[model samples]
Target: MTTTQSLPHWNMDVVYPGLQSPEFAQGFAATVKEIEALVQLFDASHVEKQDVLTVDDGLIKTFETAVEHFNSVQDHVLTLEVYISCFVSTNSRDEVAQARESELENSLVKLSQLDTRFTAWLGSMDVEQLIAHSEVASAHAYALRRAKAESLHMMSPREESLASELNVSAGTAWTKLHANLTSQLNVTLELDGQTQQVPMSVVRNQASSTDREVRRRAFEAELAAWKEVAVPLAQALNSIKGEVNTLAHKRQWESALDASLFANSIDRQTLDAMLSAARASFPDFRRYFRAKAQALKIPQLAWYDIFAPLGSSDRVWEYSDAERFIVEQFGTFSERLSNYAARAFSEGWIDAEPRAGKRDGAYCTPLRKDESRIFTNYKASFDGVSTLAHELGHGYHNLNLAERTALQSFLPMTLAETASIFCETIINHAAMKDADREERMAILEASIQGACQVVLDITSRFLFEQNVFEQRKQRELSVEELNGLMLQSQRDTYGDGIDQQTLHPYMWAVKGHYYSSDLSFYNYPYMFGLLFGLGLYARYQQNPEAFKQGYDELLSSTGLDDAATLAARFGIDLHSEAFWRGSLDIVRQDIDAFCELVQSQA
Candidate 1:
């Protein structure tokens, strides 16, 4: 059994000794001072609300200095934020870290105000002429042009500043409330013939247990736990979405999703194409689900059975085994990647234990251009190994962006998953190559299960969030109403594959994605990443050497262009239904293989 004592806690000391340490205090104070200096520079240059239509030497100089100083200030702010988040996320009850985070957020409001001023000033200028004259502007031309376009959607400077300041207490507070509540939430369950109270993350992890009774009990306990906090979580969801809806309208967005599309650097057409393909592939996913149910000797699958292991594997993948396997598989793709994964392991960059007060789910957060930290509730299964590889992929992506400025490295959510999913594919494919029949079946089932969540389950989340946003426009939804919406979404996407009576209605409360005010519609981006990464993997198979030469550059340039432009570099038409269908075809093939394996065993 994996315990918190046995698993690694990340070495945050490398970033700072402690949140209250003298070094951290000095750094935090300096970051505040730097932000204030940037504001002074903006004021001195008269860069706010300027209506300059021409570019000259003085203008070029001001633009260059502002861009450089802004980027430097952003780096400092992000470093401090990420450092504090390391503690807050791992232990939600950390009052000191929470207080510091709030303080940092308050300081960041000024930076946000400065950004509004800068965007308005840049939007009013002759951006093309500025780009032509200034090296900094030219390097950030894509971002500048996008910012100028976004300026059309801005409120007045005062309103924008007020919104930024208000968000520190409004949206930010709600988001933090949900995080703290869920992280500390526990579920009562019976394990080893004794009753025990376990963290929600631990209970959730049992959904993949070999024992059906355990999965069912955990599911019930998990639902009850969520129910206990449903009212507040519902309020959190409503407040966040309500804020987003009001702001979207104030900014002249067609809807909240319209704003998200702009933020993700993708057009509606691209999203439509991808989602259409995903919906069309639902029947194929349903087929896989039915086959898995048959293998488990059930008429239909419960939500708990969705992640259940389908075949026996004698191999138990402990943390060390996962580390070694990921490093080895990554080497086959590139030595650079393998070395990076190895370094992540040796340097204690991963927190891989599920404990009380620790948040559920896994994420890879970049600490700097060259370093990242991965958090996961790792189980002793291949699924755990695959997750580790996925996060290392994110770290590798960060490394590629090391040469770019912070602004230039800020990739959209759609493209952000590219490297992680690609790395996960590498590990999955490698694992299946030499496995025995049973092991192969297990690996194939695991891979298909993951893809199903990205495709089918994520579709449900997308639907749920969309409905919430629409309803939030009128009034806040009751917890029961929210539950009903979740169930309806599950039925719509999962169809007959999952048992209707056993659908998970509290998923809205389970997922943290809905609480984020800055990023809406976070569900579909995972689907985009998976399909896009699979498409890229197919290309690599066709021409390994050619793909290798350009892969890192493509990853590096994600922030430099929109999704369509970046996709165009490899002859991928993001708006084409055929391109999306081709990617879904890859997943369909896996579904086919899974069905065959299940039938053969039966």
Candidate 2:
């Protein structure tokens, strides 16, 4: 049977069978009514008074209950939004489908005001009084603090209302335009002596092909195609950053980075420690890259050639084989995680097929409150199997957090990758043990590619963002200027080991992470996730049983604590270099084995 046929359906019936269902429509309508009704009780001046604790408590409880209800409304809509758009995004020429997507986003955008009003209400509260309220004290201690942090930067009620409304049409609308434009841009490639219109994802993926000519051609074509839209992309970025920086200043924030840090609930010290660990391990990545360049018989490694396969692996895993492999590898780490994966696959929870209109990448969206729906475009390759493991890891993370109150289940970005990267480590290590000499090279090379991107490449992106902010303080960057910043960053991180002549200049145009207005410094979190996960995986390997319990406890605590405190449970001092070195040590072993395997073949 096909993978789709065997896969289980996610449980959406608990909420509603469709958007038109009474429960779904009623919930959405009720959310609108609640937001509209809040205006009667909303008064900015009331928040400053003391002894109004009873009144404040009622407002806080009402808001929390309303929000909990609204989350289900939005979550259900988003599930449909992603499921439907994933199909449409795969096919660029479907204008009607694309129009429908715009409508869905517009409806969501209209409710953006609800969030603004909610924030304003929270801000108006007497901080001391808000803290004293039982419902506020328990459900949203962290959120309350974060809200206060932001509320200070906000304008008064009238100005804040105007700004929030303008943002939807100005900053948000421009970013969406950039997305729509980029998504429609198609690249034509010369494959097997025939001209084929390849999706952008396929073009990029093929840049990793064993054939050097194919790799170079794909990179050249992809970048050239992106060049057409680079100017607009640059404007999109500049406009968003301008608005963000201006707002930060108005709020009396020192910088956009400071504002983001407060919102993310992460300290600058933790960020510094994470960056220090990544940079210190740069040599390990450089060594791995140099080895790959040598194996490929290239004078210097170019950006496109980084993902080139090193040796042959005739192991073509079917979807079923990949499923079993992931389950077995996860079982070796923690049976709880393993059982979660097993049930997800067996219970029809995944949409795992390469269909015509399916989305480009994989993600796990939770179903109502208890389950998750995973989408995958499986190409039956090694990377596909790894992607499956990664997404399932996210599903299990959601499963672990499902029991938490609606308020507590929101995991921070840094801890978000814990499960996904853990699953990757497990599958990669298990596959390494039994593969033949050639397959070993393929596996090791693949491992290095992922590590370098997560470590070295992310470092470059982080540097680029830092440069953008520093320069933004002086003047806006043009397309050419942004390209220069991106390339300079590449040279800095990749060192003399890379062929600078063939570096990717269109990175600013292609990567959505950089363009996201809501998040700043989106790059470093990947490094944190990988290194932290590696540390957890190392612990698991040392004492599979004892560490398994420790690992679960760590994951559970992630939603409630910071990185340093969470790592403490595992006896890992995240502030110390020793913990980071322990993680990098795992990478070193793999690099050494890969070098040996390549030399033996030579």
TM of each candidate vs. truth: 0.99, 0.87
**Cα lDDT over the full model 1:** 0.91
lDDT of 2 by residue, 1-602 (tens): 12333432344454455445677557555644544443333333233212323435566666565556545555555455654454354454566556656555545554455455555556666545665666534555655565555666776656655666677666766766665676566678998899988666667767657688998899989998888888888888887777778777777888888877665556787777777877888887877877787788777788888877667634566788888999888888768778988888887677765433333456776664557777776645576688789888888888777766545565777788898899888888888789877778888888877888888899999888888877887778998999999999999988876888988877877777766667767777778888989998887778887886666666655666556667778788767777777787888888888877766666
Q: What's model 2's TM-score?
A: 0.87
- The Cα local distance difference test for each model comes to 0.91, 0.71
> Any residue pairs clashing in model 2, and if so which?
7-348, 8-347, 8-348, 8-349, 9-348, 87-357, 153-251
lDDT of 1 by residue, 1-602 (tens): 24223789999999789998999999999999999899899999987876655789988888898999999998888889999999999999899999899889978899989989888998888888888888899999898998899889999988999999999889989999999999999789998788999889989988988889989998999998999999999999999999999999999999999999999999999999999999999999999999999989998898889988867644678888888899999999999999999999999999998888999999998887688899988888899899889988999999899888977987899999999999999999999899888888889899989999999999999999999999999999999999999999999999899889999999999999889999889999999999999999999889999999999999999999999999887789999999999998988888898899888888
Please give the distance, in angstroms, between residue 393's alpha carbon in candidate 1 and its true position after superposition: 0.7
Model 2 stretches with alpha carbons more than 4 Å out: 1-112, 116-136, 346-359, 375-377
